[model samples]
Target chain A: MTTDDWVAIWLTAKLATLTTVLLLGLGTPLAWWLARTDSFWSRCVGALVTMPLVLPPTVLGFYLLLLMGSQGPVGQFTTWLGLGLLPFTFTGLLIASVIYSLPFTVQPLQQAFRAIGARPLEVAATLRASPYDTFFSVVLPLARPGLITAAVMSFAHTVGEFGVVLMIGGNIPGQTRVISVLLYDRVEALEYTQAHYLAAGMLVFSFVVLLGLHLLNRERRV
Target chain B: MKNLTLLAMPLLMTLAPNVHAAEVQLAVAANFAVPMQKIVAAFEQSTGHKVLLSSGATGKFYAQISQGAPFEVLLAADDETPRRLVQDGQAVAASQFTYAQGRLALWSAKQGVVDNAGAVLKTASFKHLAIANPKVAPYGVAATEAMIAMGVYSSMLPKLVQGESIAQAYQFVSTGNAELGFVALSQVYEHGRMRSGSGWVVPAQLHTPIKQDAVLLVRGRDNPAASALLGYLKTDAARAVMASYGYVH
Candidate 1:
């Protein structure tokens, strides 16, 4: 592989890793609220969180460009805070990937939280344990499988991201040009050898990731 | 039963010899989209033919064409792609011709941001300067050549943001995401005036001419509507539409 291809690979890995970590941190509490609550507001928020799952990524990218443009409310706020606009930068891409992959993290984690039921909470309550302490000590450990799933799913989804990034990324080398974007560039430039190498690598890598996840899940079930 | 016959009537029309109107599948370059739309409208009106248009980067169209896409005609953003198709035996060598010559411009959404001389590039005041991907769009290659000719390419490289196509590069500038961008003059210019923004038309001497070529693909030889569209493009009426969009003869 060429150095540029390696750069794209490294960038994609970094973006996926950062997005996975951030989503896990943010999605856990939100997933918890959805799992524990039975209110109309919780349902409303849950629906909002899952919106990206159904909408096309181009729709998201289009609205995001408007929202982050100089005339946008977010843009005005960011400018006031001295951060400038957020279209072609790393921070902008991170914000986009996190939103795009939110459901991947929250859905799995939410299911795990719900599966835990109330019996464990009641047991901790009888022991006079605080809700915070019970969550860290009892709930988190029990939800390990869900946490792993959430992390893996989000990582994979972010790695596979293309459309939204294409819209906002500007395709700058060593900046917004991730592996998927690089692969697309290769194909367009008629560099078939480079394109084939990247495509084949992605095929193998994706299969390995899914196979590993499947085996891990099967082991847990057994 | 009545509606089924109504639908079948349209299908039967293709079998009738008197009706020459047939569908022509077209793959058009993104930069020439506006002019092509107007041309297609007139061509369809005159010939009663249905033109199914698919527009994107020329590089992508070349890839799809090589893979034996069912496109009857290709309107490319650069001359090279059509010539390559002819050399590869995918298109008729005699059917290829220059349809439009493109002009590059440094444009800004805000007034006065881009001076007529395009002095903004040397100062390095802008955070981002959008340009189409040099790997794909011919306008992108022109922009790079101009920047290099002006001796600002090295310093300007850090601020460059490569849009997937000229259209997207225009979007970045029009939306004020990038303070300025290099785009086709047709994007910012209309009939005898600037459309909405300020632009400096880059001098032609700095870069080679952007000769956009149209070709009838091998799959299009049997399709009368396909060749008809190519002939229609050379008409005075079609030339007028292209001229209005800042494309040269």
Candidate 2:
């Protein structure tokens, strides 16, 4: 591929990376809280967070557009803070993707947190370590595989995202035009050869990311 | 007496088998949705023929037809596709005719944003411009032509946002995702008046004529329902209906 083609690849990588990081940062605490909390309200909140997994991406993007419109509450608040409109912009795409891929990261992390068993934390507390210290020094080490899985899954999911990104990003070339949207445009223009190349690339990319993470997890266990 | 009446019921059923309503599977372009619905309703009312309308982008329909879909008629968004179908012998030669002419318009929900002379695109104040994917939608090509004619293609290329089709292009600007968008005139015209918004009717000098063609597929060449529908589209009444929707006869 030429420099122009690489630009799209680079932007896609950047967007996917940012989305995965954001999801992890937001998801890690929420997953831990959900895993530890026994309250009914916490469980309800957990369920609500997982809801995006089942909802169609297009549906999510549609509501997100309304929420991010200039007249909408979020838009008005952001405008007051000097942040412009959200939809049809790169930052808007990042926000949409973070929500769309939240479950992929959150679910695995939640399961990992649950598997760690409160025993480690309890022991650390008895030894006079703070809750944050126990989390960083003990719980995090044990849940390494789960964290890896979450990051990889989230990144891979964001890479393949289509409907939501298309709806919100508006397919601006060299800006919001990721590989999936580019592939779609190629097909629409009857450029099937280019579309095939991009589709094959995505399939291979997803497989590699998943396989590499799984392999690393297996190695860590052994 | 009961046995004789039972035998007559079966005889009547067998005799009327050929008179049952037949399905006319149609692959129509998305822009023609409303007009096709009216025409289908009128056709069914006059001839009792059942039609199953499948609306999508013309390129998608063409792909399906090439793959041997059981569509009887193709109401394509452009003449070139139908003409190609004729060349491929996938459609009848004489059956191809321009049903309506598509008109491209630059529309914005924001009042006074677009003038009929397309003075808005010359200004750099607009942040985003929306148009359908030029490779697929006919109106998209027209939009690009208008931009190129206005000498803004190079400058505005970065800010252009492409929708998959004309309907979605309209949605992008109508929902205010983009400041303005290029879309089909039919999308905004209602009840003999333009919808509450400003739109610039693209001049013919900017682009090639968008002569939309409707053709009977090879499978429907002899089908009664397909023939009837094609005939109806050529009528003055149908032309008038299309005109109301901003289609040129």
Candidate 3:
């Protein structure tokens, strides 16, 4: 691959890494609340958080563009905070990917949290353990597999995302042109050989991540 | 079982014309939306045949047509696509003609953002400058050409935001993500005047003529309606509509 090709790969990895990190940090609390809470409003909020999984990524991006444009409320808020508008930039792309891939992260974490059961936390509470102590000491350790799955899923999904990235990122090389967008550009330009190479690379990368997760799960089951 | 028969009766009635009904599919480019919408209406009014239209980027449409989508007519953003379609036997030979010439403009929804000379790009007042992807969209190619001619390609490269098509490029500026973007002039025109947005119409000398072309695909050769629309595009009435929308003869 050329230097430009490597640049795309690097940017894709960076974007995926940042998106996964942000999703994990933000998703844990929300996923916990959804898993533990029984309120009707909590379920509604949970549904809204997972809404992106059902939306076509391009449609989601279209809405996001309006929400994150200069005149949009979110954009105005960001601008007031000195971050500028949130479309057509690398940072903007991260925000879009995080929202787009939220369910991939949150769903897995929620399932994991639920699997841990409330019995452990309740027992810890009886033993005079604080909520924070029980969470860090008991809950988090048990939910490691779920967190890993969520992170890997989020990262991989972010890397593979095309429609939303194209809609919001604008595919500027060395800035916002991630690997998937570059692959699309190659195909559109009739550079089939380059497209094939990039596509194959992505296929292998995604397979490796998924295979690792499945192997871990198998070992745990064993 | 009595209710089942009642439902089957209407289903059978609809399926009775299986041999007589034929659908003519047309793959249209995004920029040809207005003119093609009119032509389709007129053609259907005169011929009494349905035209199923699917509009998208010309590059994607070309890829689909090459893969043997059942599209009978292709209204393309550039002449090259129709020529390629004909050469590949996806389209009828000698059935292609330049239907309209497209115009490109640097537009901004923000007041006074785009001047007539387009000097704003050089100063880099805009944090993002949207344009269609030059490798795929014809309007993008023109936008790049205009940027190159104006000596802003390098300086603006860092701020460049490339859309898959002119439609999305317009969306970028219209949504105010980027201060301005290169768009089809037709997108910003209404009734012989430019819309509320500021625009700098790029000089023709900056780029190759965007000669939009229409071709009857291989499947369309036998469809009378498809042929009629292709012919209708050249008529005075159609030409006037195209002209009003900033298309050249």
Candidate 4:
């Protein structure tokens, strides 16, 4: 691969890593609330969080573009904060990735949290354990497998993202051009050899990641 | 029951001919979408054939065609792709011809952002300048050539944002995501003038000609409808539609 290809690979890795980290941070509490809450509002919020799952990525990207454009409300707020516009920048791409991959992170964590049930928390409460202490000490350890799955899934999804990035990121090299966009550009430029190489690399990477996840899950089950 | 069956037989026979109407799948470049829509309508009305247009970047269509996409014809924004397909034997060598000449323009949603001579490009006052990806869209290549000929490509490189197609490049400028962008004149031209925004039509001398070409794919070699549509594209009615959109035939 050329230096430009390496740059694209590095950028893709960075975008995936940052998006996974942010999703974990944001999805954790949201999943907790979703798992424990029984109110109608919780269901509404849950549905809202899962909307991206059903919506076409391009449609989501188009609205996001408008929302983060110069005339859009988010753009105005960012401009006020001296961040200019968010459509073509790395930070903008990160924000989009986090939203696009939210369900991938949240759903798995929610299932894990729900599987914990109420018995463990009740026992901890009887032991005079604080809610915060119980969560960090007991619940977190039990949710390890789910957390791993969530992290890996979100990371893989972010790495493979294309439509949203293309719509919002504008394919700026070294800034917004991730591996998928780079692969697309290679194909468009009729560099079939380069495109094939990148496509093969992605296929292998995705397989390895999914295989690892399945193995981990099997071990947890056993 | 025999009497009813006899009455329905003539109706069924008359409707049977409509089922034989040929469908031609056309892969059109994004820049030609506006004019192509009208041309397709006119062709359908006159010839009784259905035209299904899939518009996108010419490079993307070329890639798709190379991968064995089931398109009957390609209306491309550049001559090279059609010529390449012909040379590769994917398209009939004899059926490839220039359909239209695309005009490039520097456009901005806000008025007066682009001057008549496109001096604003030299000023470099905009924060972001959008253009179609040069590797994929011919107008993007022309835009780059124009900038290079104007001696500002190097300086303008940092501020550039590349869209995947001309349609998306127009989106960036129309939505104010970029201060100005390079798009096909057909996108902003209407009624012999620019419909919205300020624009400067890039001179032809600055870049190589954007000769849009059409080709009959090998898959459509035996389809009469495909050949008919190709011929129809050269008709005066179709040429008028193209000319209205600022395309030179």
Error of 4 at B93 (Å): 1.7
Model 3 residue A94 distance off true place after TM-score fit, in angstroms: 1.0
lDDT tens per residue, model 2, B207-241: 88888999999999878888878898988877777
**Residue by residue across B1-249, what tens digits does model 1's lDDT show?**
999989998677555434788999999988888888989998887778889999889999999999989999999999999999999999999999999899999999998788899998888578999999999989899999999999999998989999989999998988889999999998888995678878899998989999999999999999999999999999999999999988998
What local lDDT score does residue A71 receive in model 3, on the 0 to 100 scale?
A: 84
Residue pair clashes in candidate 4: none
Kindly give the number of clashing pairs for every candidate: 0, 0, 0, 0
Candidate with the greatest DockQ versus the true structure: 1
For candidate 4, the per-residue lDDT at A191 reads 95
Tens-digit lDDT track for model 3 on B1-249? 999999898776566435334457888888778667886776665445678998878998888788888889988999999999889889987899988999998899977888999888878577988888889999999998988888888998878888888888988999999899899998887677778779888888899999988899998899876786778788887887888888997
Q: RMSD for all candidates, in order, please.
A: 5.5, 5.2, 7.5, 5.5
Off by over 4 Å in 1: B1-18
**Candidate 1 pairs with clashing backbones:** none
Model 2, CA-based lDDT: 0.84
Q: Model 2's A-chain: what TM-score?
A: 0.95
Runs of candidate 3 with Cα error greater than 4 angstroms are B1-22
What TM-score quantifies how close candidate 1 is to the native fold? Answer: 0.95
CA lDDT for candidate 1: 0.92
The candidate scoring highest on TM-score is: 1
Residue-wise C-alpha lDDT for candidate 4, range B156-175, written one tens digit per residue: 89999999999999999999
- Model 3 interface root-mean-square deviation: 1.0
